[model samples]
Target: MKRQIIDTIEQYETIIIHRHVRPDPDAYGSQMGLKALLEKNYPKKRIMAAGTHDVLLSYLAEPDCVAEEDYNGALVIVTDTANTDRIDGPYFDRGAFLLKIDHHPNEDPYGDERWVNTDASSCSEMIYTLFEEGQASSGWEMSAEAARFLFAGIVGDTGRFMFQSATEKTFEVASSLIKQNFDRTQLFADMYEVDRKILHLQGYIYQNFTIDENGAAYIKLTQEILKQFNVTVAETSDLVGSLGNVKGICAWIIFVEEDDQIRVRLRSKGPVINTLAMQYKGGGHPLASGASVYSWKEADEVIGKLQELCRNY
Candidate 1:
């Protein structure tokens, strides 16, 4: 499959890379890292990262202005996105051929060609494997800029190697990526640093979270609380993992209220939570998943289900 993707890369003069919306580091890393790799090797070919620019991720690279006409003959490769509905940019199907490269389960598969590796830590890691294949078979070379993006993705999805997803091979990939000339220290600073307002919200969560006997915990960040802290819904994502550090916590959920609905983030040390995420309106990894609910009543229902899962586990 790697060889086939490399072959397809050689066939096109225009390529557009995309990722999931509500962008994360893994999303940007895989999409732009692949763009950097392709641009370095095939400098003549036009490669663009297509998506809305996320200001919070300005520490990384920015996306390009890919108009509709640009996709007419482009080879569209979407990375790190599980399903079609989650893909960020439009006109993904307007291209000549569509490709899906992701590390998520192939539950909602699309594209003319698909490479899904659920065992891989992140799509950025899979992109590195593709680079290895390209190096041997296609004489491809990776630039330091590409390495920075890929490394950030690996670290982000694996929680800086704290999550269970990081494997022996994940460490090996990180080792190889660091050999390229990039500022690892600065990258780490940019990836982990949170604003003062965000930190205050995290403190509030630590102080106010509700926990059950089964160690099922939850915190609700209502719009009122968000205004109180002057924090946006997007910035609240950094605090979702705060509950994992709490003692006797088996599973946790953080509900952030958006304009009309609530964003549900589910994380677990023991029981599967993606099933719970699916019961709402979202899905992701078993240990970490996300969902959306319409009201506080539905939010309570999700919490009840999570408590049941933890109790049974």
Candidate 2:
């Protein structure tokens, strides 16, 4: 599979990288890292990273605006995305070949070639392994920037090595990147740094968070509450994790009101929440997932289902 991916890359003079919309660090990192890795090895090839911007992860490279003509004869490689509908760009199928590389469950697998591995901790980890193996077999170069980007992805998705997905192989890949002498301390600082407004919002989340008798904790952030705290929707991304450490809380969710609908981020200590997310028009890892709802009633139903999951546990 690694050889096939490399051969596909070599066959194309132009490559366009895509990921899921509403970019997270893992999405940005894997996409940017792959772009860097390909450019470092195939310096002459034209490679572009395409996606929506994420202000929370702006430290990474900005997404490129690739024209439709660029995809005419290009190879499209999508990273960290599980489904076709979530891909940010419209030119994904316009490429000569579509390659899917992800660490999510193979639900909507629609690619010419796929390297899906659910066992891998993050897509960044998979990318690191690909480059590590490719370097030994085909003499590919792994740049420091690429390493940093991959590290960010691994750390972001793994919750800084706290998530259950972080296995021994995860550490092995991380150690390989650490050997490149990237600044781990600086990366952690950049990822964790928060302004006063965000700090105040965190306080609000802590103060207003509610836990049901079933041990399902949750916080709802409406647009008015966002304005009250002077925080953007993007600023609330990291706050979901704050509810995870509370005792007796088996499942947790954060509901943020979006322009069109309600966005949900789901996390569980020991229960399958992805399946539940699927019922609500979303899916992700078993322990961590996401969903969106059309109204407050739908959001309440999701919360009710999550509460039942906690009770069953």
Clashes of each: 0, 0
Q: Which stretches of candidate 2 lie over 4 Å from their true place?
A: 194-202, 205-230, 236-313
CA deviation > 4 Å runs, candidate 1:
195-199, 205-313
Q: After superposition, how far is residue 113 of candidate 1 from its true place, in Å?
A: 0.5
- Residue 255, candidate 2: alpha-carbon lDDT: 94
Q: lDDT per residue, candidate 1, 45-119, as tens digits?
A: 999999987766888989999999999889999999999999999989999999999999999989999999999
TM-score, prediction 2: 0.70
Looking at model 1, which ten-residue stretch has the lowest summed lDDT? 190-199
- Candidate 1 local distance difference test against the native: 0.94
The per-residue C-alpha lDDT of model 1 at residue 152 equals 95
